[model samples]
Target: MNDKTQDIAIVGGGLAGASLALLLSHHLPQLKITLIESFPLFNSDNEKSLPSYDDRSSALSLGSCRILQTLTIWSQLKPYLTAIEKVHVSDRGHPAGTLLDYRELDDISDEEALGYVVENRHLGQVLLSALAQQSNIDTISPATVAEVTPQADEAQLVIRQGDKQQRLAANLIVIADGAHSSLREKLGIAVEKSDYGQVAVIANITSSGYHDGVAYERFTDSGPMALLPLGDFNDEHRSALVWTVDSDREADVVAMSDEAFLQTIQQRFGNRLGFFTRVGKRHIYPLALYKAKEQIRRHIVLMGNAAHAMHPVAGQGFNLALRDCSALVDTLCDATVRGQSPGELDVLNHYLSRQDLDQEKTIGTSHLLTLLFSTAETLPAFARNTGLFGLNFLPGIKAWFARQAMGVAGNRSQIAQPASSTAAEKRIK
Candidate 1:
């Protein structure tokens, strides 16, 4: 077996792993990084070959957009994005509803939308393309990590590619294999999980009326549903639909005829965007919240879905992960200046310390929203509707809620700052 040494090794090449690799390469060009994946990487032509780059869409919060913008590839992703100008939230049977407009935000200008939505495939393409252009990053795909052994100084990885094997040593190892992480299990890391007893049915839909860049979040007795605006395809006014339902209804919902599915969703979602005209392919996945017991070890770090997976009722999952990435980058950059090893426990702990509060707040809010909106209990129902109604009258509270949704409510990371203000940008040139 051949042996190699690198400054860092990433276990997964999915969205989180790819984004981390790019951030590291951009900010710390002197460090040698290796990215490992079980699936083939850079096969953009065959979208099905890559599981992460599916037909689903991701809502990029304003803060997440700023993070991507700092990477200098947002322009490449711009054409594929659909801006969300307003957010209309309401309860199915209640007369109370609130409209969150982008113009109402104090920090955001009229030229900027509250957030943007882009197809996952397009996002994957841009990230991969940027990774290909980095000179300091090495990608090893169509392979897997069979074992990881941490030593006194660094972590060793046993890699497998078909019949051949290789040994790799790195100062730091980032695990981003997904929510169901096999690598995390091998390391004896435990996770706390809460099953919501629900599943989300996702599909792209067309409506008779244009969406006008308005995203809708409507809560029903059954569950919460969201319709996020999408860029038109083939001249059809389109939106992405995420409808949560009881787990027992999964098979029936996926098996429904297109017309039946459209009618059912129309009845639940109302006529905000006119009648539901077309329903595309449907996909279903069970809903659960999972958080790793430990995010950091002596020479390891768990990232993205591997560390925390929350309910999507509030659309905060990916945005939170991106913020974690930004914080990690900042911490590592500081370590390099101090002439410290990235694998030091103190360094890893500092990274976690910076993110612990954000993670706790984001995860707690998502769980609360899922529970508060997924039931018809008299007390909870009245409280939620009253809160929604009050948002219309309370500008301070409503703005705070909007900032939370935009992923900019709390302290912003320095790495997510604009190119001119970020100290890391100086290293790039």
Candidate 2:
């Protein structure tokens, strides 16, 4: 075997790739690893895709926070996170008793908080910065995989990188590319696609009233509209909005003037936060549920959006990816210690099964919730408020849902602790 095919090669270094790199770097410090980014840079730092600036934010479960914290990566992005003291879930245009407060769940249990909302820029910076200093990890920019072919033992990757083209071999191939992955398709892995027929509109807005760390999710006939808490910007409390709209209205929303648009937001949003004075850059993604028929192909393994593109309704895409990375990290580390191949069936299946179970359940529930809430005429009046009603009245059920949102629902790892409780405590103080 050639020297190029010794360790592992990771393609597409986004959230999934970066997290895996950090985990592997921490657990198997001596193992040689190379990460290749096909893009020259990411959108937040530079103009790559979408916009000049990405104002969209992500809802991070407390569970994910602890994973990063354990990896020594949390401190890097901690300054940019906006704590969520409570999450108010309700039907659109609902009144006081209609909402579900996360604090109520804690009264029946030990911890508090549903999750935290953080800007994508903050997370991108932390993952990027951590990768920059790792001596054992090689980061290659502006590289494209021209071809890949697996032999009896070694897998060859022909990469055409700016002004240079070369073939590299590795024991295992990892694909962390985005939702529509060319790498997975290259191996002829078939995926089932289910369009949600709605678009998730994302933008950062300056909320008129004080947020006080309250995140809100109001479900409408169109879809769930969530205003997640973020750090105050320019004396205004910033809240990132995810408004899922019918596919037909997506274009109009994207083209709306900032002032007129804020007015529209004010109408649909009502006066909970008083007003949404302004909106930063915006993005709209056509929501879909895409999952591969299989997770592995000989020497290759797919992770992140590539493995399964989930609906943003529940905000578990990245969380699931983090889970996948954790499992892969454990599998690879154990393999190295036990003198096994990183791409072996035994190790890969451990990672696959862990991800598949969560992936299936999350995609199933989120898709159903999306369909249920988005259908205005499909529900009986009382059925409309079932979940919210349960959240407001049911103690055991509410805390469980809150913990589920926090990514601490069923953590197998002791280090997989959540930060929402601590953040909630600080908010109370």
Best by TM-score: 1
What tens digits encode model 1's per-residue C-alpha lDDT throughout 247-349? 9888889789999999999999999899888998898878999999999999999999999998878888788989999999999999999999888999999
Candidate 2, which segments miss by more than 4 Å at Cα? 1-3, 41-45, 49-53, 94-113, 380-382, 414-429
TM-score of model 1 vs. true structure: 0.96
Please report the candidate that would top lDDT against the real structure: 1
Candidate 2 residue lDDT tens string, 1-429: 123654778888887887888888887887778888886543343566322114568887766776777777766677888777777777765542344455554332343345567777667777777888888888777788767787766577888877788778887888887788887788788999998888999888897798888888777766788888888766877888999999999888878999988988777777889878888888888898888888886678888888887878778888878877777787777677789888777778876765566667677777777777776663533565766776567766666566656666553343363434444323221
Reference-based TM-score of each model: 0.96, 0.90
Candidate 2 TM-score to native: 0.90
C-alpha lDDT of all candidate models, in order: 0.88, 0.73
**How high is the lDDT of residue 1 in model 1?**
93
Off by over 4 Å in 1: 45-47, 418-429
Q: Which pairs clash in the backbone of model 1?
A: none
